[model samples]
Target chain A: MGRWRALANAAFALAVLALGGFGLYQVATRRWHVQPTFHVQVKFSTVSGLEAGHRVRLQGMDAGVVEQVVAPGKPGEPVELVMRLDQRLRHLVRSDAIARILAEGMVGARVVEITPGRPDAPLVAEGGAIESEPPVELSDLMKRTGASLQKLDDLTRTAKTGLEEINAIAGSIREGKGSLGKFVGDEAAYQSLMSLTHRGERTLSAMEDNLAALKRTWPLSRYSDSRSFFEREKVLYQPGSRRDSRLFRDEELFEPGRAILTPVGRTRLDEVGRWCKQASQPQSEVVIAAFTNDDHDVDLAEVLTQEQADSVRKYLIEKHGIDSAGWFRSRKVAAVGFGTQVLRQQDPSLAQLPPRRVEIILFTPQT
Target chain B: MIARGVWQLEQFGRFVGFVALTLAVLPRAVVERFGEVLWQFEQVAVKSLPIVLGAGTSVGLVTWLQTHRLLVANGAESALPSFLAVAVVVEIGPVLAGVLVASRMGAGLAAELGSMRLNEEIEARIVLGADPVPSLVAPRAIACALAVPLLTVLIDASALLGALVGEVTAGKLSPLLFWRDSLVFLRLSDVIPATLKTAVFGLLVGLIGCWTGLNADRSTEAVGRAATLGVVRATLAVFAANVILVPCIQLATEALGLGLL
Candidate 1:
């Protein structure tokens, strides 16, 4: 019985030893998963909070562990972190991929987070060094945030001062202390200003009519007849002839329903001027015809087109000095407004052609 | 009250002397009566397995449950096995085994020795030219010193198993994964020194138990008192030895450049 008891005791001891040995074996072999792994290195400017055994994550998924943290051997050299990542995830770590050390929580362990490269990028080879971005120090972030807050405070103070100045100006206007205040406050001044604006408009219209009649009377009469003939034949002219026309959309020239040229329109016109100078012949005539697609009100469209044509001619003659009196005397430039009539005459079958447009036609006498 | 205090201090001084004497005589005792040491080993260690395993498993489960909840809040639930393993293997398992053994075996040794002293058996040995220190104290002390470390290994294994059970029941991890993750932070430096410290705990338990028992007065009531005193003193000695030994081991490992701790 005593022998049996001793044997039992020995067996129990063996069992205990076996249990402990098994635990030790698990620890030593690291038999968690049979998946293969490969080694890679990443260099960082500062690995302050990182440790050797901390996890390495590939795009937020647990991939492997940091094997070693090697301090810089030479001054100014970055710290090297050796990592053993799963072999299957090798494709994720590409040549262009970057590894960053990130704190898991406010006070938790730091982990290496690898941002994947483009799918087509070459895989990071074994023993190769991948790129690393140094973790943004909390102090640096706080300093930058503090500077931005200071700038915001200054901006608020400046805005407050500007608002105060605006308030003072508004108060002056309310009290009838400025010219604008007088316009609003005094009935006589407001009536006079309105009458003056009306008179100016009437005078401008009268001058335009006089100018038109003058052009038809004397030295410009021959040029006006030639331009009218050119306009009449422009639609029926053969395509192969030495005649080129460039079309500019309404949005390219002016804002909707307005005759004023936009900056983009001015730029387009500059290009046209350059092209005209290049293509000009001794007998070449340049015609600027403005058209509108106002099916609702043809009269208003005609007026708008005429005003737009005049504006373009005046800008070229005054701003660009493209007048007949210039050294380039061979070029003859004229303005004409066809409004919706041009659309109806050109393509009568189509219900709608396009938006408002300006066509610049350059014609040389077909030799 | 003053006399009682003096008497307690004297007893403590004698106990310390007895521990020193036991250490001095250990090598000769092991050589002379190794079989007797094995017998005591089977009695003290084998008999104490159930209670030690239970303590270890319960402690591990509690640790895992509490740490899991805490780490889950921080999104670090994956680190639970590693934390529990390090905690159990390096600190909790050895200390728990020591304390348990001290309470169970310390009381038993004290009562047995107290009864023998009361019956004049120790006097009979001395009269027969057999030294009571070698025949009586040495075998039991050596057995305890040897058994505690082995028992600590058992405790560590049981605790790890318990952690596995806890993790599995929580439905967050598989047994295989838990076992793998548990080794993440474990180091040889942590395991070796921690296991070795239980030997010191065992030595303390044996010396205190025997000292209290042999010093008991010749009465039936004295046997009970000796047993109670042995348990209390041995338990305190285990804690005190841990406090001293832990730092010493830490410093030694650091000096050796192990850096495991």
Candidate 2:
């Protein structure tokens, strides 16, 4: 009986030890339905709530366990996590795969979630580092969301203020306070403007009728032929161009108070003739104007200036053999005289240089 | 009022002295009567296996049922085995084994010692030149201490088995799958400390039972009272020790960088 008791004790002790040893083995090797696993590392900037022994999941399926978490030791170095993933799921952990620390549930355990890379991507090498995204902090998200809401509030307030200002302006316009209000609300002013516009329209219509009549007349008919209605009416007092004008002094090109060209004038005219031949286009127009500062005898000064301009035209046509009929595409070369009318009002320095002068003006129509 | 308070303080002092003496005599007892210790071990561990198994299975089944309902509501019914495994191995198994031992074995030890005291058997042993501590207290304490951890292991295994049964019955989980899932959350850090703490529970049960029994008056009524006092005190000590041990274990694991807690 004593021997039986000892045997019973030994058996019980052996059973107990076996149970304990089994438990220890299960815990140490994690041998329950164990599968082969491979090691991989992931690096994170901040792992805050993640720890070693946390579950590692592949596309939300349980695949592995976190073996170790090495915290950042130096500045700018990321926290490294060593994970042992099941060999069956190794294909999911490719070189381009990303690992993120995520919560299982709102208040449940945190897990490492591995997002599978493209199938064509190379398999992750043993112990290779996988990319890691740090856990999203609720507080930081809230702060950013709060800032966006604040900006939205401010925008709404500003829009409201702008709408109020627009309303005020509309009210003022309705009350006939500003110019636009008068235009919209004052009946007398409105009638006066209407009448003025009507008169202007009538005047424009009459002017059009007169211009039509002038175009039908002998000399101007040729100028109005083939012109579009949208073309602007040509004005006689159009601005002059200093760049296209060539000036000749009376003493250099003509005898004092005389209309005939001198020897010196012929030499100057020769240069002008060459310039006109070179610079003038087929459609260019030229004007020759002569001015005299002999204000004591206005009629004589005018007659003398006209004669001198005519002489310059004659020299350009007769002496240099310039074409008068078809020169510059049938545009006539005109000669005009102004007797002391411009010299009295001109700059004193320019008036002192030469009182009697002629100007050759060139006109080139803009295409 | 003053006299009552003084008597209570004296009782407290004697309890402390008894615990110290038991601990001091433990090595000598083991060295001298190793065979006797093994016999006591068989009594404490082997005899108590059925009760521990029953309690563990019941606890695991109840835990699975309740946890399944809660987790199913959240679409997490699959996590039941993992949750049950962690709950049982880390906490429920060891604590339940400790309490069961304290209630059943503590009462038995107290009654046996109380009867011996009442029948003057302890005095007879002293007269025979045997120290009561090594001959009596040491083997019981050592056996209790040794047995509890083993019993805890049994509880863990039985609880896991119960969890498997529950999973297979309620869900489509196979036995192998359930076990695999169960071990998902089990870690050495949590298992080791939780299981070892039951040894402390065992020591408390032995010391308290022996002390209560030896201190009982030499009467039949006192023997019965000693048994009741032993169960109540030992059960209370188990719970109290659990509260202290859990935090101490947590602190120790944290200090060692285990991070189990």
Candidate 3:
């Protein structure tokens, strides 16, 4: 019985050793599954917290792990990453697939996602390199957005300031403050406007008469030859009338047959005798300035003549006819008061002029 | 002064006597003459098997149930085998064997030594010039040191089997995968450290038993007191050794760069 008991104990010991030994043998030589899996490589400037065996996911589904990392270049250049994917997804991955890192949640792990590439792209191979963008970290995105918002705020402030200035100008017009406001709002503006209507009619009539004179003198009007003759004739036959005086200042402004102005322009009568001597002098390079009661035109015609006034009239009658003078009498100008008010309000310097007469200055250019 | 010197000499003589007598009675001679040690082992190992197996199985089952209950929720059920195998091989097997061996052999050693002191047999040995320690304590120490490690191996195997059964029942894994894949982590580091811890446990249990027994006085109460001290000290020493040994082994393995884990 004791021997049987001893045998049983030995058998139990053998069994225990066998069990442990078998387990140890299996542990030593056990083979794990190694399938051929698809993978892609990405490069980054810095992979801050990334590590091998950290999750690689598609959308949100975990598909692989980071396999290897290499820093081939100097520190600032991109760091390359190699990832190993599961075998099941080999068929789905393509060459042109764009992979990017994405945040999983408000504060969760980072994951890689392959946004499907163009459908026409060729199949991606195992160990093929993939291009990917780094995820925008929370702090970085916030910093960029904050800067953009600041720029937008500056732009908005500038636009608001511009709008406010425009409003102030418009408000001034509504309150009848500036020249435009007075023209549209004040009763004195209407009176000045009526005066401007009369002045405009007179100026039109004068321009017509000048045009008729030119028409009659057209045959003898050589651009160079007549310039001295006209300058001389004007000096010899100066009219005896105040060129700055208004013909009538009556308050019954719109009454028919009223003359708005009757002024005689200055004539150069002494220049007629000097014509032969001054003929080759290039007419002193004649310059004339024309101003309204408002701002001057700055650009106006200049003329030079050296003929006697009666001789120039005879030259006009012989060269052209009476038809031009009749056309001049009927010319009447419209009443806008546009030039009058500009002179009156903006430039206080021009406020002391005759209300209607246009000023013309003639001069030669200095050498 | 001479009396005090003789008294110290007597204690030394007893310790030497235990060693000499234990060596004189060779294991083969003991087997040939009485077969007492073998008989004692059968009684201890076989009688203790049920409780040992029960404790191992229950520990494995509780570990599996609790760990998988939490791990499955986190999708980490596949890691259960690695968890259970490392835990059992490293810490649980040695600790359980040490605790149990201390209770079984330590108390017995203390009791036997205490009874001898009380009966004046120890005093008789001193009168004869044969010391008491060689006669009484040495054989117990040798036997415990050899036996405890073997028992630990058995316990470890039983517990792993229990863990496997629990894993299968829980439906968290397949029995094939458990046998094939899970068993792959049991490397030499795992086994060597475990068995080494068990050997230390055996030496500790034996030392605590011998020390407490020899210190006992010749009183009825002293016998009980010595046995109690033997179990307490052996259990505490086992725990203290574990605390020191685990970190030491971990550091050594890390320095050597020997294991994958």
Q: What digit string (tens of lDDT, one per residue) describes model 2 on residues B197-217? A: 999999999989998899999
Each candidate: RMSD: 18.0, 18.6, 22.0
Number of colliding residue pairs in each model: 0, 0, 25
lDDT top scorer: 2
For every candidate, give the share of true A-B contacts it also has. Answer: 0.32, 0.50, 0.24
Q: What is the TM-score of chain A alone in each candidate?
A: 0.44, 0.43, 0.38
Which of 2 and 3 is the better model by TM-score?
2
DockQ of the two-chain complex in candidate 1: 0.23
Candidate 2 regions exceeding 4 Å error are: A31-41, A58-64, A73-77, A82-97, A115-129, A143-367
Give residue A72's error in model 2 in angstroms.
Answer: 3.5
lDDT of 1 by residue, B36-117 (tens): 8778988889888789889888888889889988999988888888788989999999999899989997898899999999
Instruction: Name the 10 consecutive residues with the lowest summed lDDT in model 3 chain B.
Output: B28-37
lDDT of 3 by residue, A1-367 (tens): 3888878877765766676576555554331114456668888766656655445775555566666667766756888888777777666667777677665443344666766566678767777876677767778889999999999999999999999999999999889998898777888879998999999999999999887677436354444224543442242122342122112111122122222211222122122213312322222211111122323331111121111112332322333321122433321111111222223122365455544322221122234
Model 2 lDDT per residue over A69-130, tens place: 88889999999998888898887889989999887763468899999888899999999988
> Residue-wise lDDT of candidate 3 within B130-182, one digit each (tens)?
65545444445555655666677777777777888888776567877765545
* TM-score against truth, every candidate: 0.63, 0.62, 0.45
Order the candidate numbers by TM-score, best to worst. Answer: 1, 2, 3
Q: Could you tell me which residue pairs clash in candidate 1? A: none
TM-score, structure 3 vs. true: 0.45
Chain B TM-score of predicted candidate 1 relative to the true chain B: 0.95
